[model samples]
Target: MAKEAKKIKKVVLAYSGGLDTSVMIHWLKANYEDCEVIAVTGNVGQEAELVGLEEKALNTGASKLYIEDLQEEFVEDFIFPTLKAGAKYEKDYLLGTSFARPVIGKRLVEIALAEGADAICHGCTGKGNDQVRFELAIKAFAPNMTIIAPWRTWEIKSREDAIAYAEKYEIPLKITRETNYSKDGNLWHLSHEGLDLESPTNEPKYDQILEMGVSPENAPDVATEITLSFEKGIPVALNGEKMASVALVKALNKIGGANGIGIIDIVENRLVGMKSRGVYETPGGTILYFAHQALETLCLDKETQHYKELIGIKFAELVYNGLWFTPLRAALSAFVDETQKTVTGEVKLKLYKGNLTKVSLSSPYSLYSEEFASFDEDDVYDQKDAEGFIQLFGLPITVQALMAQKGEA
Candidate 1:
């Protein structure tokens, strides 16, 4: 820690213009002694959070402020690939925080190199997973640059202490100890952690916590039906209207949020090896995943689909563990892309009270054959053929049963 700090004259920080990051700008200058802070905020569809950010950064003593609109790139490059791979952490999590970290880190490293900064700093905490995600990405892109994680070295202990420091340094912040719930948001999803969520048994105060979207309990009773189109597993249109990748997500977020489509709560195992509770609102992502899976069921054959299901689990872990820039993740993504070649279709879904019910689906590559599957009459299928096929398919089970019978006798 001491060794890296000695030479860090300037740092490009992944700043959010939020409580922690705003505090970090002043804290870095104070602790590093005459060091310049270059603040970089990636606009990955954080919408309102970006308003007036430059003023905040400058007020907090940032030498410069860079706000890049990464909505399209983030959706196309990062979000789509992960969505195509069906990478959901645990059974419920959408890997929102998992994937957003690297995208943000990529820009941070880019700014660091452009500014000729000696190090990259971040506001991620010591205990949480973002530290690993951001730092590992920085190492992947700019290996030689020093990486500084302020949470690990800062003297301020808790949220309360940080608030005190913010007040003392005259850093503008809207958060206090009682109201602070650590949150991360992007185009994909919004996640809430800390505070009452730290306990698995405690029920969340949804009124206080539901910032991104409403819960199903509060949603309107009427069900909303919509159709979504996909091309090679990438969502392309909503309700027959073609949309840009970023626009599609934004549209679904509103429609899904209105119908109370996406809200998840889980006590998940973190990358750093502790169980943590998070409540996530992934309105757009849930719709995309649901629609894409329906398309896959229509287009993908049984063998390829089953194999990809197994791959999805591994994909989820790789994303969650911050291995996005690694060769293994790239290799897995290549396989996922291959499977998605024929996964083009439109899927109809009914969204109501947190439920996304599959109503109908169609695809150009659909393997479903109504004629062959019919019970009444079809030249394409013969009942006699099933005798041979079933016999062969069940051979192993028959043999095992015969062995058991002989032993019993």
Candidate 2:
């Protein structure tokens, strides 16, 4: 007689309660045959979506459902650190989804270990960067555990197929024929893709799909001013009132969203080496990034600031590519933390129709000295000293030019 097939005892799935993940739950159960599926949902910032997720997961064939409230950790640990580094992928992306992955992935791994599951599963497609990010993070945290990427293994290829599969299995899905955009939402941002957005030539209609932020066309004409206070590069207060991390982020999201503060459309380089067009709405993140950057400008020195800019570029790349668990990222974070020591202050910003304009910023550690920087006669800094300073500064360039002249002669 043939040996019996090895059965998967249990699997921890990173469930989003979306169409893809909803379909994945049944698919995993059917394929594995007798496997107990445990669904884990991370609450980064999808406030409304979290309402019925536990019940939905249980209804969709998950033996157990774990919804971890990770909003505070997401903001304090992941979001703030990236903000402090001034990390922006390719100059446009605030990496809202990028930073959220590691935190979620860590939780998934933790739950998988606790449950003693044979494998960890995710609904991310093989074509996307998220699959790479999720799998890499899983490997980093649990090297010995097996990873089950259903999208790569499954016959379901498109959204239509996913919808069909969900329908066949009687799985409940929020998306319908009228609204079919693939969206990823967290406390930091909400991203929209698919349909008209799939074509870069087609302009995104502001009225149709924007959920997190107000459309610029519909935004209030009056500019709204907000004051953000930071201590050692972390946002601690808003408008002179100290609030909790979660509360502050939610407040900023509300204020910035009202003013249409953060909406970015770009074709970004995915980790899978493809250019994907995405429309991101990151109201609170935009406010935080600008305010933190302005505060750093007031506190950090020229050399440190310049170097930090370079670090920001690399840091953004690392986070976007999903290499959050790597040593290079840790080293970069350490450098970023050092640069942020004096990055304490308050920044006032004017929010008007998708623009966050820094009005003024003040820091106790501010390197800007009015007496020295003033154009008018000041007691500090001698004008004559500039002549000697300029001569020394230009010495190498002068020598190089003189050498070239001598050779020409």
Candidate 3:
């Protein structure tokens, strides 16, 4: 530890401009023997959190601050790809915080290489998934870059300890220690943890915890209908109006938020070998997932759709565990891309008090045929063929039953 610490002359930090990171800038300098700290923050649609971030980092003993606008890239490159892959961690999570880490980590590596820094730093604690996500991405990008994870090494034991450190350093803090909830936000979603959420049985105080949008109970009574257009599986238009990827998510956020469309609470299995409760707010993303699924139903064949669902689970696990830069992920993405070739379509949905209903879906590559499926015996199929097909399909089950009957005889 001493040798590595001495070798790290300069470090690029994945600074969030949050309380933990504010403490980190000063802590790194104090502990690392005059290590130059460059704070790198990604503007992944954190809304108000990005305000005065540069000033905060500079004031907190950082040599410089790099704030990258990653909203467009985040949506287009990360979110859309995940959406197209149909990846959902633990069946409920949209992998909001999961995928955001890779992009930030990638940028951190780029900055470190450009600045000729020996190490990269992050405020992520050892217990959480983000630490793994950040570190794995660092290893993938720069195998030899020393990683400084202060939470694992520092004497600070809890948020209270962190607060004390902040006070000692006179680090300006907007984060209140009173609120035990830990929150992470990006263009994709908002995640809340800690506090009363530590207890799985305790119902979340929605009024206090809710931020990105209103709760379902507070949603308006009237339903709002919206139309979305997809081009090769990417959302291109909202309400029939063309918009950029970032613009589309922003628009859906407002629409979905107004209708109380997205809120998921689950006790998910963490990669670090523990179950943790997470309350996620992904208003726009939820709508997109549902709408995208509807489009795939029309475009993808039955076999491809079923197979892709299996891939989705694996994709979610990969993203959650921070393997975004790996070859498997790239290959999976290529497969997802191929499936999306005929996924262009328009979907109409109605949002009412947290309920998103697909009103209609139409695609140029739709495989639905009313004539073939008609109950009145269409020319495309004969009813007798179904009997033979069913018998063939059920042969294994029939044989098992017949063999059991022979044993009884």
Candidate 4:
């Protein structure tokens, strides 16, 4: 008699309710001898996409579905720290998807452990950064848990193949070829890709391509001024109105989107050693980034501000490359947190046609003294004091010249 195959008792999947993940649910059960699948959806602000997720997961063969609301934790723990650090990959890409991955991945491990699942699965493709981000985070949190990457293992090669598989299994999916643009939306931003955007040269059609923000051409002619209040580096209010983090972000998204505030087009280096052109809409994130920067200018000292710039570069790279769980990132966050102790203030900004400009900023910790920086003579500083100060400041140069004169003498 042939030996009996071992059954997969349970598997926890990081489900996005997308076509890939939706199909993955059915495929995992079929291939693993009817394994009990547990679907875990991390709610990092994918508003309506999560509407029928629980029902969809159950219908697709998941024995259980866990829809975790992680928006507040995402904003407070991950997003705000990156914002405070001023971390931007390649100076434009704000690392939106990059920063959100660890939070989701970490939660997946927690759910997997609690459910006593043998393996954890994800819908990330073999070529994407998310694969690395998800896997690295799993290794960091649950090093012993088995990882199942369906895209890398399964027979499915393309989106078309996945769609066919879903159809064959009678699984419900919202994606179609005509409206197909692989999108990842969360509270912080929305990313659009996998259509005309695949080609670097093809110009993205404003009307057809974008979802999260309005086009600059259609933006109102009148400039919109908004005042953002920050306390300890986290955005606390918008235009003097105190609101929840989620609500504030949503409000800013509407205001910023209408004025065409945050649309970024960039060719970024993926973790898989490839460059991909992606267009991102991060309206509220743009407002927060500008506002936070303005507040830092007023609150941070010259040296701390200069050194923090260096830290910002590293912080962006770490987040982009999926090292969010490493000790170095934690240390960097500690330093960033320390810097934010004084980063409490309000920044007035003008938003117009995809531009966010700082109009004014004020903070109690401001070191900018109008009297000291003034061009006119004042009682606080005598004009004659500059002669002695300059003499002392130039002593090294004077010494070098004196040594030359001594040689001639």
Candidate 5:
């Protein structure tokens, strides 16, 4: 629907085979003059969503479909770095969908260039954060490439309108009117939005919507205990069995989900300056973040640990705002890597009925010296030294009190 001065010959779409992208394939071809639509799906741990995706894309009117296996890189490059940075959007969201956009957008640009496409398209809506995420990545990689966002330009106003359009074209859909919650899934987490979730007062239909795990009430009566080993802040093993990063996360997802560990319903402030409600299930990610912070207590010094917490807030903002490819993020990542150097350790945890309780933690780099911290007398730290230290620390307070007495006199 956007008016363009020149005709677009070909478009490479970041296809997810979801309702929006599925509708976009036909919409692009029908609207543009002889525009060849090429579809690119990034396999970023969407698991079962990738099943029969090629057949679906081609059937939906795409000339060719490319499914890029991006799971390993997604876990290693994107997920781990963010994990090390300790970034969490709005303090609890874990950024399940935020970081996935850049990697997908990068692939979209690559395929568009390779296929000699004039534009890159995505199914991101105007109201959501994904539109900025997708377009910003596209702009970073392919500044001049025409980006077509159908949700921003199209006549379809709501999911109901999109469904009607899809039904008219006979496009196969996996969802129905009752089950049409906007969802995004990956290795780290699954997110649900729209529909009944839009109302803040409506308690989530957890029995109906939960896919990753059971509700707290349905979790096993017994607690589940697990040991997580980390090397340089990346989780290397679960229960002492060393596993690949991808496999480790998947294993924890199963274990953590069974115990009903990680589920949060939050009304978050979107980057688009609108408030939206969402339910997130991040069982594995929750366990990892908790364990990593526990390990940093043993490894990181007081100053560095406190400062990194500040960095985490800014890091979360950058990622949430789709500024991953920018200089500030790269610089922050570098600082995070430095902080994670000695973050090698093991942590034991108990998961029970949506609660994570730390059992124990240990590290070779631990700065905790019992000799100096014990209640009894110890030679390592002199008790008399505290008298001078407190005086110097409270000098400003003493000076202010002296000035108050002088004015009274």
Candidate 6:
């Protein structure tokens, strides 16, 4: 059952300065008996979206706006852990928006608690995964706090309803009827959904909707090569030059974006039990994941590496389902960290026309031995030993066949 939003004196809203949120500030006041609304917008690398947000929030009716700079923490704390775990939702999505929700939700709770706010509000629609992501994180931190999800209880039904409410209230919005596509952007990636993208049969209008980079068809002919360095599984440098986490992602975004890399269109299963289509441009994150995996290849042993693949799939599901702060996720992260102790290394990659080609990879803790793997004569390993090993390995199969041959009923 949805929680009741009653007796709420003050509410803190997760404001994005987008269409829904911009209209929400005014709607909350009108519907919630004119409750005091304080808006909080986390600066998780929504570059242009941050512009004049304070003025917009204040103008619309928010008492005050808090735009917290969470880019560095978003990368170091959330992104690196997922990257190290090799978590990719459904083998494609890099969990850009998925991992970002918890960080922002945590900050929302902080601001709400500090301001003595009675309830927290959000503009997420009822059918979206973000509503689950935001509310779960909020409940984890502030279990007693009231969560006011207007979409579930309000008269507004769809994007059209939202725009009508905004128009009725004389509220300003950046999106129009023609360009009203649902978008989520942060440092790691930019995602586009809704409109023509909702139809699986229709090809994405990449030429018109792409914001982070150009389409693969229009990518530059020449390949772009870059060297990336990692320490304890976190990206620390690019092209042999050390950089801060945020700077490194930004730099790689520029390079990878130019090369038309890291764009994926997927029909993902939402936690709401619906399949939604989206196109994600994760240039920097794609490069980082590729490089990290290359380093792991040289560092991790077969057993550990293969087992970690299962862990990665689970990690992806957890993040996609918005279980970021749970104990299982933490335990998994700890195990990934242990594996990453030897994940310190450098990887050189060539990016061209949306393709990532590994040029070279090296690590100090590399387990690869050229001598044992070589076809030429080597004293390190004896080929004759394989006979006994294969015999033991095939014992179960041999016994099953012998039983059948002897007709042992």
Report how far residue 235 has shifted in candidate 5, in Å. Answer: 1.0
Better of 2 and 5 by lDDT: 5
For each of the candidates, give the backbone clash count: 0, 1, 0, 0, 0, 0
Question: Which regions of candidate 4 are displaced past 4 Å?
Answer: 1-7, 382-409
Scored against the true structure, residue 199 in model 3 reaches a CA lDDT of: 95
Whole-structure CA lDDT of model 4: 0.89
Per-residue lDDT tens digits of candidate 4, residues 302-380? 9999999999999999999999999999999999999999898889999998888889999988888999889987778
Q: Give candidate 5 misplaced runs (Cα > 4 Å).
A: 1-6
What tens-digit string does per-residue lDDT give for candidate 1 at 360-408? 9898889998887787887887789989999999999999999999999
- Compute each candidate's TM-score over C-alphas: 0.97, 0.96, 0.97, 0.93, 0.98, 0.97
> Against the correct fold, how does model 1 do in TM-score?
0.97
RMSD of each: 1.3, 1.8, 1.2, 2.9, 1.3, 1.9
Query: Between which residue pairs do clashes occur in model 3?
Result: none
Kindly list the per-residue Cα lDDT of model 3 for residues 228-329, writing each as its tens digit: 999999999998899999998988998898888889889999999998997999999999999999999999999999999999999999999999999999
Instruction: Pick the lDDT winner.
Output: 6
* Per-residue lDDT of candidate 5, residues 1-409 (tens digit): 4356146889998999989999999999889877889999999888899999999999999999999988888889899999998999889989989999999999889888888888898899899999999999999989999988888878999999999999999999999999999999998899999898999999999999989999899999999999999999999999999999899989989998998978999999999898999999999999999999999998999999999999999999999999999999999999999999999989999999999999999998888888878999877888888899999999999999999999999
lDDT of each: 0.88, 0.90, 0.91, 0.89, 0.92, 0.93
- State which candidate, 4 or 5, has the greater lDDT: 5
Which lDDT value does model 1 have at 66? 94
User: In candidate 2, how many clashes are counted?
Assistant: 1
Q: Using alpha carbons, what is the TM-score of model 2? A: 0.96
Error of 4 at 78 (Å): 0.6
RMSD of 5: 1.3
Candidate 6 minimal-lDDT segment of 10 residues:
1-10
Better of 3 and 4 by lDDT: 3
